[model samples]
Target chain A: MGLIAREIEAAGLPTVSMTSAWDITEAVAPPRAVYFHAPLGHQTGPAGEPDTQRDLVARALEAGVSIEQPGEIRALDLRFPDATGWEATAYTPEAIPMSPDGKPNRGAPREPRA
Target chain B: MARPADAVPYIERTRALYARQAPYRWVVHDLEHEPPPWTPIRSSLASSRVALISSGGVHREDQEPFHFRNDVSHREIPADTPASRLRVSHFGYDIRDAARDPGCVLPLRALRELVDRRVLGAIAGPALSFMGGIYSARLVRDDLAPRLRDLVLRQQADLAYLVPA
Candidate 1:
């Protein structure tokens, strides 16, 4: 994601990214970013929370405009609900479902329902 | 800003998780010397055309799903597509929340609402979606980035908002 942001920015388009993974964002170092300590797949906000999502998106765009330094990742002053407990279990082997080969099955397609 | 108290050590956890998979090793790209590209915003949010991009594997229900691994390809989802018509496919994280409310990742609906409220001027182009778990940074820099850049250019977007899952 950071790489793509950099490429787009290089092509003369301003870009701002919202990232859940600080480590990866730090490594790739996009032109601009807003860090969310939320869990993966919930970078914008919690599911079914429209107000929170809109607020975050607005703040991210604000950061894109106000940020002066390149590669700046401004951390949002917010937390996901149940953040502590979610962090404790996220990415753990026991928490991930395993396939028949004993590998994590996180990639399998689960189509969204309307 | 101080690090969030609830921040997770995702890098270490991901490394350990990949280790358990034995043959598959996950490594974050470390670009020590490369400076980030820069383009200053020349327009106000209320007047600029903005594009939405996500690395959350979101695609319209009728579009083909991204390949689970090393899939650098992207999907161009029309900006006006209903959230209910979207789906997600990816491996790096649990996608249940995204499937339930793509606003959690893609946030296309939120973008539209912003436009309606005049917080943003307009949707510049189709929202672009792609899988972000690709192990090869080369493919992302070479294949995926250029394509997305071209699309954003074609739309003449003044700025782009990216959401990475």
Candidate 2:
């Protein structure tokens, strides 16, 4: 999403991406992105909630035009009902396989935030 | 401007969610980049030709689904198409929310409403929709982005609103 948005902006059209992954967006640094703390599929807001969806989308668009610099992202300033649950299954330390060194085998998560 | 410090938790949350779903595992993307390119809107929002896009893998009911689990292919969705006529097929995110109300990700309804209220001049044309989980920058650069660029140009859109997964 980040790379694609950058490429589009580079082609001379302004673009903004709505994202559930602020970590990744921070790294790739698109022209503009709206960070949503909501779940992956609910970037605008919850399903069946038109007003919230409209508000968030409109805000992102407003940011796309009004924001002066490139590589900017504003967090979606609203709370959503179901933004959790990956905490349990994403990388349970106990559920991770054990390595040959007897330490928990785990893949790297997000890199340290810059 | 936002400091990187403020982004720590959401970044972790992003990596956690990705780790939960994807088969191949790696750290979240961490790279330095030049400032993104810029293009100011030439006209006011009320009279600008706006376009909408989404990485939610939405497509018309008769169109084929994005191919493969990790696809770089994209689909074209008409601006006036109803939300019920579209479907989601992305591999990266939970499709349940989008399936129930694609406006949550695609926001076509909102775009149209804005147009109706004269907040926008008009919808440019069909919006580009993609599965967007392609990890390779080369593929997105060589395949998907060009096509979308062409579509945006064809529509003469003054601005684009993209909801990426």
Q: List the residue pairs that clash in candidate 1.
A: none
Score candidate 1 by lDDT. Answer: 0.80
**Where is model 1 more than 4 Å wrong at Cα?**
A95-114, B20-32
The fnat of each candidate, in order, is 0.72, 0.55
lDDT tens per residue, model 1, B1-165: 344556677778767767645444333444546778788789899998999889988888999988666788889999889888888877667788888888899888888999999999999989989987777767876788899989888998899998888
lDDT of each: 0.80, 0.68
lDDT of 1 at A69: 79
- Give the per-residue lDDT of model 1 (tens digit) for A5-103: 888998899998988777667777888889878878898999999999999889878876888978777887777875357778777665443332435
Residue B40 of model 2 has an lDDT of 68
RMSD in Å for candidate 2, one decimal? 7.7
Error of 1 at A79 (Å): 1.6
